[model samples]
Target chain A: MGIIAAIDLGGTAIKGALFDGTGPLTKKNHPTEAKKGYGHVLQNIDQLIQRMADNKGIKVDEIRSVGVGVPAFMAEQGRRVVLAPNLGWSDVDFASDLAEQMQKPVFCNNDANLAALGEHWQGNGKDIENLLMVTIGTGIGSGLILNGELYQGKSGMAVEVGHMVIMAEGSHRCSCGRQGCVEALTAAPAIVREAKKLMDVPTDCLPDVNITEAKQVYQAAASGDKRALQVVEKAAYFLGVALANILNFYELDVIIIGGGVAQAGDILLNPLRRTVARETVFFQRRPTEILPGMLGNDAGVFGAARWAALGEAKKRG
Target chain B: MGIIAAIDLGGTAIKGALFDGTGPLTKKNHPTEAKKGYGHVLQNIDQLIQRMADNKGIKVDEIRSVGVGVPAFMAEQGRRVVLAPNLGWSDVDFASDLAEQMQKPVFCNNDANLAALGEHWQGNGKDIENLLMVTIGTGIGSGLILNGELYQGKSGMAVEVGHMVIMAEGSHRCSCGRQGCVEALTAAPAIVREAKKLMDVPTDCLPDVNITEAKQVYQAAASGDKRALQVVEKAAYFLGVALANILNFYELDVIIIGGGVAQAGDILLNPLRRTVARETVFFQRRPTEILPGMLGNDAGVFGAARWAALGEAKKRG
Candidate 1:
């Protein structure tokens, strides 16, 4: 039994968890000033992993491997971030560098993909073989598990479901600079943007409340606010449209919705179910189940641990 | 070496070919008269197979398997045609019925899918894995071969690339009753319709010309007719759009273009390449090689033979 360090690299904070052969032993979080240069963040991760390992009474040599989750497309063979729009980094050899510093086998993958794997290993998708984990945060992201394996396709960019065009000629600019991306319209920020357009919202109720906050939009919708409800429904429509298209393409059994905006619960799910049912071509054949994510915020950390476990298994084999 | 009986079931005729392990020993064609009854067609296939095998000096017992192809979605288990809009057949269990009479293992699949598989086995895709074979004929149809295996999704409706929406709001009625289907605008008939509306060609100039016949459009386009060229280019645009989308989803190495319309060669391919270059989201990342199919009219027959071979292998394993 060896310890493995799992790192969830977010924009604001770098979350790390140390796991002994079985489960997590300790967790740590530190602010990531990405603008300070990439080198600084790299050093920060190395130090954090070491500190976590030390706290757990494990030596650096005792740790079998390290799993790092980043926000981007990871190449299948190289395990490098091919394109990460969020980090403003390109062609970064993350795995090799992380391995060099940590002095162990390092495995890197898309954060959402690792999250899906995490959920598959210990969360709601534990019993399911074919599952789609749709994360609804500031941006909509998805990770697909097809036929009991992570289908990364030829280039490991196969499951870029968020970039898929849900609505043709949709009037929204996605973070990826593409139009009609499911992420552009269905994400938390997009929901808030839609809710802010209501002329009567400010005067009627919550006069000084900011519309940019996704939770405010959810609260207003929960209070029977017409504009807020429409905004949430529209977001759900796009999400459902994308989910339906994916269902038709891959034909998965269930879609687990996670992330911050998924907190809206029934308000988001009801409209999404309606839109998915109406838009899907094979609605009559079999209906896809939409369930809330069970792993919550620790999904990425759990997934990172799962990734390390799998890597250890592969190495042992 | 065992002889294999292959059947290519078309709307007008049933083409039968007998293969002695590698190449065709003898070929025979007969009127299908599908509108009459399913039993009549089945009997015709039986007689046709017998005649071909006899001509090749092969005993009925020496024949390994009978492979049949249809213009519809084959069920996951390859037992029946789940849906064939053109043939107006649903859940037709041709396998059990044909197997009972032949007293041998029988295999059947979608003609387009078989064509793709046939190409993969002996034609253009022989050396390549992870290919998308698109047949541009009466309607656009595709078959995906991923990781050296035919990807038949959950409901055996995997590579339905033609039905994918190209123009979210293109004013066209797809044969599937869906609007904005790539097939609706890019199919051979659609090209001819656009050509006829744009050009005034004399009957003598293009003999035996019809909007439904892809050859007519190719003829006009080849003769330097401006309108015909425009129509072909338009179709190529939509076709390229769908292909690019597929490329984004699956980073395939090659896309083998087949079917009757693909006979036009560069008249369709040149524009498709250019359009795919401009439209594909991942155009800057993974580069895909597109080429015309080599199997031509014999693709289905060869595919049937290959399918039979696969079935035998599976049974042995």
Candidate 2:
């Protein structure tokens, strides 16, 4: 069986991996360094794949296909990325361009969808037919797996959960030029912003709480910091509201909360679960299991590999 | 070919039809008269079906199968309805019970889902693979058609769009014991409540708005009633927000707004279209057509007949 080359292109890091049918053979990560320009990123990705192949005693050209996952709107059947602020791209054919650079057929999709796919293939949701995987990092991103397939709506813009407004008024503004989006209230920066709002009124917390990061807020909350706990509670509540909406809308089986913010563990999860239960329409039906992503960062790469394999099989057929 | 009996059981009326393969041969309606209890309701339904068959010069026993649609949470593969306050039933196996009364195999599902399926078959959707049919009547009910199949989630409780929270704070109370739900803010009664609240103020239109019913609100709005326009605007905005959330989540091709409330026409639809465009995540993608249903009340019966046909085929397979 031929090898599959997979890459998960992110704002800060580019995760690359090789799959040999059964499982991954080698995996590594490199700084995205997107500021260096598109050509630089492309050459770096090509080099990364070459090195991965060399390490596995195989030539880069021997790979069956290259699958790439990007954190952006993938449209026109993955021919181009509509917009990717991190990569400074808009209406550019990243997929086809990369295919040209590597001289091979390329398979591409949204990173969040790939993460859901990877999770479905071997992570927390292993082989489940219906799932919604949400990644909560600098911004919130999600992907849906429906009827055993990745559900990218008509324009390849399905599962955009972050933009769903929970609080219609008196809510934080989002990057999408909207207010009260789920992402604006719960992403890492929002978590830290909310914590800082209550930093003036100290209650069982550090006297000079220099909590500039979401991780620090989580740390403080874990240690019973009252203000930090409130911040986490608010974020978790909004996330749960959105989840409840999703659950009732599609009735998903599993909802995997991944990315940087989810590492808060039980503190973040407990409040989230409580809110979902309170907000859910199907209290009597089988409740969807809300879990943290098991594959972590490797989720996108695994999904990319699977996507490539499927694409290659389809081409052959 | 044997006849297929189809029924759309509503709160006040039972719509019964007999279909012979291609189209309905005879159709009729009878008052539900649910105040007489479950046994009376069941027997009445039997008579209604028998009359439909008799009008087509066929015996009741000659029917191949019966397909029924109810406005409630259908569960356990449509074996029983968990709750249908309209019919005053709880945990009742409507499918098997109807099967016994009709002396034939029966297929049962949510009325909204069947509406969607019917729309997909011959109504506004018309063979469209991906659609969301929302019926705004006494309560908001919705059913999804994805990839040309009716998408009923696990335990058959999917597309409960009305219960999703749109206004988190200081919103009206919903029947589900929640506040600010899409149903609470935009359903027929909600529209009337909102109009009544505005009636106290003087508008350029009605002297005594006395908008006792949702139909009157539409009529008022149609005549350019400023207060009524405000109510319609508010309802349209919330509905747009919910539809935007749905459009982003599933990426369906068309959205059919049926039931009695959608009769407001362009007054409701124009504002709804404008709001959807404003709130959509995929501004550049092919926009989902938000249109009124074409089949009117017949959408459910057509869907029920289609459901029976498919079910009967599956049984043989």
Chain A only TM-scores, each candidate in turn = 0.94, 0.95
Clash totals, every prediction: 0, 0
Each candidate's B-chain TM-score, in sequence, is: 0.93, 0.96
Q: The CA-based lDDT of model 2 is what?
A: 0.85
lDDT of 1 by residue, B247-282 (tens): 666778789999888999998899999977765654
- Candidate 2, residues A1-317, lDDT tens digits: the string is 47889999988888999998788999977788899998888888888898898888998878878999898877865667988877887788888889999998899988988988899988998978889999999988888888888887666764678988877653677887656789988999998888888876555556667777899889888998887889999899889888888777676788898888988888999999898888874443877888999999889999899888877888889
- The per-prediction i-RMS, to one decimal, reads 3.2, 2.0
Predictions in order: lDDT: 0.78, 0.85
Best by lDDT: 2
Candidate 1 — which residues are off by over 4 angstroms? A50-62, A166-179, A189-210, A213-215, A278-285, B54-62, B154-158, B168-173, B192-230, B279-285
For model 2 the interface RMSD, in Å, equals 2.0
